[model samples]
Target: MRRIRVAAAQMGPIQKAETREQVVARMIALMDDAAGKGADFIVYPELALTTFFPRWYHADRAEADHWFEAQMPGPQTQPLFDRAREHGMAMSFGYAELTPDGHHFNTSILVDKSGAIIGKYRKIHLPGHDEYDEERAFQHLEKRYFEPGDLGFPVWRMLGGIFGMCICNDRRWPETYRVMGLQGVEMVVLGFNTPSVNSQKGEEGIEQRMFHHRLSLQAGAYQNATWVVAVAKAGSEDGHHLMGGTMIVDPDGFIVAQLGHEDDGVLVHDCDLDATRFGKETIFDFARHRRIAHYGLITGRVGAEPPPEE
Candidate 1:
């Protein structure tokens, strides 16, 4: 039985005034709780070490860089790693990354039980605009602060299954899951910080926002026949409300575990990795069912164009 106990470590608001050390300490406390619950793996939300800074626009580069880490497991994050190693717990978490070359990316890293970095995935589908719009309630300047991720969707063999990682907006893209699905992924872990209100969809309500989040995750899990562990950085941050519906979905797309509160909490569940086999080999079998030849537009076309000649 390839069973692994996992936890969706949902975080509450990280106040704008909070420091990285304070946030890491809070994460460690959540890790302690997950460990006590016998969880083998814990998934944390995107930008785990800071508030959702992208909600506000920063004119100065130095101000924006403050939210980014110069190195993985850097000084502020090393304690979390140390604690994970001590407890023999594997973890996946997200953060803003600043490369040595000064480029920045929204990144997530997977750490094995031994506290070794096993895989890393940078967020590819960046949402929002670069320029700030005064008419909007708040700014989502991710495009201005982060460069498009250079790393493609990749899967790694870890914790007795094929694991893949994606961050925030990447969860909304079908291509993100399909790439990993094609790689035979058995599980996909993701972190998100979605606001309850979006400027692009100003008329939409919070119910719709949460519904879309779950819909995307459920669809991705069922289509790929993979377990999905999605964590959220939710609640109001400096008066800005964010949605929190952290959940764990089975290979059949049913939510087996979910957090009910918009606060710091953990939802633990024992997931059987082998549960994916039945679906993979039957109705959803990619090898036997997928018609790649008919998907030429997905692979070849860049923008809207005419259909292929008959």
Candidate 2:
């Protein structure tokens, strides 16, 4: 029974006025709580350190440089590494990354119990448009701010199991999980900063949005036969609300533990890596069931094509 006690650390929100120092302090407080709860691993939400800045647009894209972290542990974030080392807890979190060569990506990292970064995944499925559109209720300039991830969905062996990482919109795509699932992933940890309402459709409120969130995670978990720990940076951010449904899903896609409110909190559960074996060896055994030849369209084409009129 290879078991890992994981904690879904759901954050309340980070206002634009909040400094990295203040945000790190909040993360540390959650770490303290998780450690006390006997959690050996902790997952924090996407854009964990800052308010989701892509919501705002800058005429000069360079003006948003202040929001990007040129280095993962650059001064303000080093304490998180130190605390993880102190608690000997493996952790994962997301942030906006600015490369030295001037590339930007929405990224997440996985650290081992020793506080060493073992793997990194840039978000491939970036949502929203690059150009500002009056049609949107609010701007989501992710395409303009960050390039799509160059690093593919890579998995790493850690904590006695194979683990994978994805961020926000990446979770909404099946390919994100399937790629790692092919690598025999036993666990997938992800973070999200999702708006409570659809920016384009006013009728699509929190209820529908939350339903999709659960549908994505649950389906991904069950189909892949892996445990999924999803954390959220929730509540109101500068008057724009982000939904919180931080949860831990089992191999059968059942949510074993979930956060109740859109607030700073942690949900811990013992996830036995062995739980994945049954489904993986049976129902979801890709080697025995998947027919790749018939799936060419998934990768062969990008946009949909319709049949010609008779």
Q: Write the per-residue lDDT of candidate 2 for residues 118-174, one digit (tens) a residue.
A: 999999999999988999999889999999999999999999999999998888899
Assess the local accuracy of residue 65 in candidate 1 as a C-alpha lDDT between 0 and 100.
90
lDDT of each: 0.92, 0.95
TM-score for all models, in order of appearance: 0.97, 0.99
User: Least accurate stretch of 10 residues (summed lDDT) in model 2?
Assistant: 257-266
**Candidate 1: residue 116 lDDT (0-100):** 97
Off by over 4 Å in 2: none
Cα distance off (Å), candidate 2, residue 161: 0.6
lDDT of 1 by residue, 238-304 (tens): 9999899999999999988888889999999999999999988998888899999899889788788
* Clash pairs, model 2 backbone: none
